[model samples]
Target: MILHTFTLTLGSTRPIYGSAHELRGFFATKFTEYTELHQHNADKFIYRYPVVQYKMIENVPTVIGINEGAEVLKQIFNDYQEIRLGENTYQIVERGISLKDEEFGISDKIHSYVFMTPWLALNQENYRKFYTLKGKPERDEFMRKILTGNILSMAKSLNYDVPGQIKCDTNVRFQKDRLKDVSVMVFSGKFHTNFLIPDLLGIGKSVSRGFGAVQQLKANNEGGSTCSSSSTQGAPT
Candidate 1:
């Protein structure tokens, strides 16, 4: 399958202090007619996987648009000159936008990916189950399953048919994070999977707010991989 993606990066005179959530709010408020930007329809939240995701890549505010969302982004690529986050106002000095058609779906070889932002892999119920696991091995196994399911959900959202069972292996470190002012468990680190996920695309929960954003790591001859320096370096604590 082919995934159509559009990425917009904004550069400001000063460092941008806003999180993805704030970035999203700025655009959603500006373009109230576009539901993809906010994933909300009136009072209820849209349950489908988000096609438009907001994030902070390398400390700069970035937005990723997929498929239909890409079309929406193209329509408003130059609509904003400034963004306000909390009490901080940033004047946009440089804007970069790129559109691409990327390969998506299962591949024969495994690819390595690192979470650019924290991966919200567990909910309240699963959070309790994860802690009750007997050992590290069990916990890792459980996480692997969760990661696989995440991929499957993304595929289903895009209407891509999975020809085979999805396989995943994770090497992550768990940590506590605050989402919407509520403390929650999140994961950081990398995973190996046969699925070909596009860069800057988000998985797991609250992806529209930038959690679970991942980028593929390019493999080197030393059997290690190097992540793109332009991508995220984890969300601020």
Candidate 2:
């Protein structure tokens, strides 16, 4: 699994946790719903996305590729330094372990995990090629197919297992201006969730990515939201 950390602004007092599948599903749904609700087709809103990060704890294996991907991650973390992990957030210099062992005076073997640098992809074919995925009433059934296939393909290319587990923070507010389908899909969940989009206006870089200090939550759960609570649709932002 591509084990990485994500930085976000905390929207609720509740802690957030989920499997990789759940997290991806959470975002994919958010994006799709928002766009559809605004009556925009998925193709129109869909674009090749960045590697959304998730800050990992010490001892978690990190494989940095020796390529463009590595360079991007390096640049990404340059200005960004903190991440919101569930309720607790931290700075990279304080929270981060060495991306490479030598910098930390540790042997490579002791680290075990390879520093997956960016340029390793030979043909440079791998990042992601997310096409405009049209959403329908039966979109849930297609989630596993599109989300699983695409993510797994990237992990396989990077030589990591499918990140079965994923963690994320919640988006404070829902973007109001979008597609009609997006709104329908967004509210069509078991319960309401905090994760939404950056804003009604899609400006700036991906809001999903960042590194900074954050407030922590005391609550925790397996996936989605409350076990028995209905999850509000989390359309991609």
Candidate 3:
């Protein structure tokens, strides 16, 4: 996997919100009009996993991982050298793409993980699952189930065996009309080789729009093996 990062100096630093939506629109308009991942041919439609993922951090549009899908936008943006983000036009200060190592920064030993971007654990259907929990204990128990299920789903997506035991901190955050969690997963089994690289692959839902983004945290001997967790519910967006 390759990660392409675009650094832009916005005309004003007014703290842009809903940046993911803006970034998504910018690429969709510049690259292709179709909302679904497909290319229209004379008589057939070809489909494949869209390898492009992007999010704005500190006003920079960072392309999480690059592939056939990302190359088109990369070329045009780098060449054209300017972008219109909302009412402000951003001048590209610098751009670079780096190859991602597959190791996921873990050795044979146990390690901890963290969410660099908020991990959306629930979509519209499951939002009530967490909401109905009455107290901390109930909420925490529900969180474990969601996190474990999320981990298993992610593993299955990559064709890896489900870990016998998964431990994580119950850190939940709400943003952008999404229920997100930033927790650590400690796999009891051998860590998958592909995870060694800190690829910002979204885990739960709406990953194509940059939700559920997770990354490996630096290992430490201080924390307990059990997953530490937290959750916060924001006002309705």
Q: Give the alpha-carbon lDDT of every model.
A: 0.84, 0.25, 0.47
TM-score attained by model 1: 0.91
**Which of the numbered candidates is closest to the native, going by highest lDDT?**
1
Candidate 1 lDDT, tens digit per residue, 141-195? 7787777777877877889988875656788999999999999999999998878
Per-residue lDDT of candidate 2, residues 175-208 (tens digit): 1222212321111111112221111111112212
lDDT of 3 by residue, 158-177 (tens): 44453344444454544444
List TM-score per model, in order: 0.91, 0.23, 0.63
What ranges in model 2 sit over 4 Å off?
A: 1-46, 52-67, 75-93, 98-142, 152-237
Better model by lDDT: candidate 1 vs candidate 3? 1
Candidate 3 ranges beyond 4 A from true positions: 1-18, 33-50, 66-77, 104-108, 159-165, 173-199, 221-237
What's model 1's lDDT at 100?
100
lDDT of 1 at 13: 95
State which candidate has the highest TM-score.
1
Clashing pairs in 1: none
Q: Which of candidates 1 and 2 is the stronger one according to lDDT?
A: 1
Name model 1 segments beyond 4 Å from true.
220-237
